[model samples]
Target: MIDVTMTRAYEMMVILYALSIVLYFIDYFYKQAKIRRTAFWIVSIVWVMQTVFFLLYIMEMKRFPVLTLIEGVYFYAWLLITISIILHCIARVDLPVFFINILGFIFVTIHLFAPDQVQNPLGESAVSEMLIIHISFAILSYATFTLTFVFSVLYLILYKILKKKKFSKLWSRLPSLQQISMWINSSILIGNPLFFISILLGLEWAFMTLEGLSVIDAKIIGSFIIFVIYLIILVLHRKGKLSGLNYSWANIYTFLLVVINFFLGSKLSNFHLWY
Candidate 1:
């Protein structure tokens, strides 16, 4: 049976994340510094709760519990929150943290409410270490892409606001379009290499464990398509064919496709789905 105490703590964490998001938006639009500070503190508290839950979960499982889809999503959400906190302190940026926590909230909420299948914990030998490395890099790459997508979105929003001459407090908070573009480009540069390495490792694992690499697998094809899309973006950026709003729009479209592939296409995949 599920541990009721841990389950309650998890639900509370979700609530805190949601509350923090609401506070952030309120502060953004209202220009309330106090509310923004409160939101940041709320985020800190939420992180602490998440840490407690993590410790409790590890104690209960006697191993890291990220071998399955739900657990993996939860772990990723926690990871993003941790990174967001650190980045926020160093950069004093709020919008990215707001968007990240929103995504984290969604991820954890899904993990909490969705029907979870119980499976025995696997020993370290059950899954090869190489596969874990591949999956870790894949998850990190996805997280990096998410940040890039967020900055691109900020570029678009700020551009529209500037064009319309509707200035708000949030306007001042956003980085310039040039800065946002640079961040997007850098994120893609970092994420693409990591994802490329992940694919290589995955292929290595397949060659070693399976009859042969499954090039036709739905997940592999979907991942390859996303990779190609990003590669195109990188090429366009390098050749000076895309920049500013054009690049931002392309990122938005690519990110939308990525979201669909991750959330929907996985359901159709033979190997990627958790069930």
Candidate 2:
């Protein structure tokens, strides 16, 4: 009965953790104070539950719970949650808190489904959940880059129309070139880090979960190439060497590469059979 209760509590904690992550993501995008407060409360509850479990483990084993791989993972997750709460409350930084909680969620999931922790029938499902998260991050980054591309295209169009002195209702409705350029930069700033994080998570998952997965897989290579290109573009823009038309065109071309990599590279990869 004790074991069953513990398992159910663990499951509930995981669910709340996931829900808090989703809420944080929404708060990040929407900037809703209510959502942020709710997420904070939920995360606080998760932290309390984690603390309870940590104490229980220490009492049961008569030692700190950091000696083994599973215990260390749980402790690491707890630390992440603790730091995230500090950042959320004191620092009030949205992005760092969100990303830290993402890492915390990953570690928490790792602890929950680790074979040594318990005989969990959902072990395979946990692996699938990780895969889904990896893919979701990649897709979110890609979508952000696509937004950058659209803004770049609009910039070009507006630039051309102004250059040709074509004054119309569309000219009044379209955002200025500077505004579009700012959007382009903002999108890349957000998307690039997300892409980098996704790549790290993908490689970690592939190495730990999949057998005989190659680092040279087409999808992996393509992802790295895309990441590098964006990094370079960002650097160039920061140095003021790439801007205006060149910057816009660079984003457009990079997005085309992203499209190809996402489809063709996936098809070519041996282990990336799942779309």
Deviation of model 1 at 167, angstroms: 2.5
Q: In candidate 2, which residue pairs clash?
A: none
- Which residues of candidate 1, in runs, are more than 4 Å off? 118-126, 273-275
Task: Report every candidate's CA lDDT.
Answer: 0.80, 0.79
TM for candidate 2 is: 0.55
lDDT of 2 by residue, 1-275 (tens): 99889979998999999999999888766778899999999999999999999899878865454434466567768877886898678747565567678878998999888866432222443355455456556756865686677678778888898999996753454567887788789889998898988888888877887778789889999999999999999999999999999999999999999989977997898766333
Q: Please name the candidate that would achieve the greatest lDDT relative to the true structure.
A: 1
Candidate 1 local lDDT, 1-275, one digit each (tens): 46787788777878888888999889878878899888888889988998887787778766666667777787788878886788678767778878888888888788888776446434345467787777778888888888888999889888999999997765788777787888899889999889889888887876776564457876677778889999999998999998888899898898887777777766876555254
Top model number, TM-score: 1
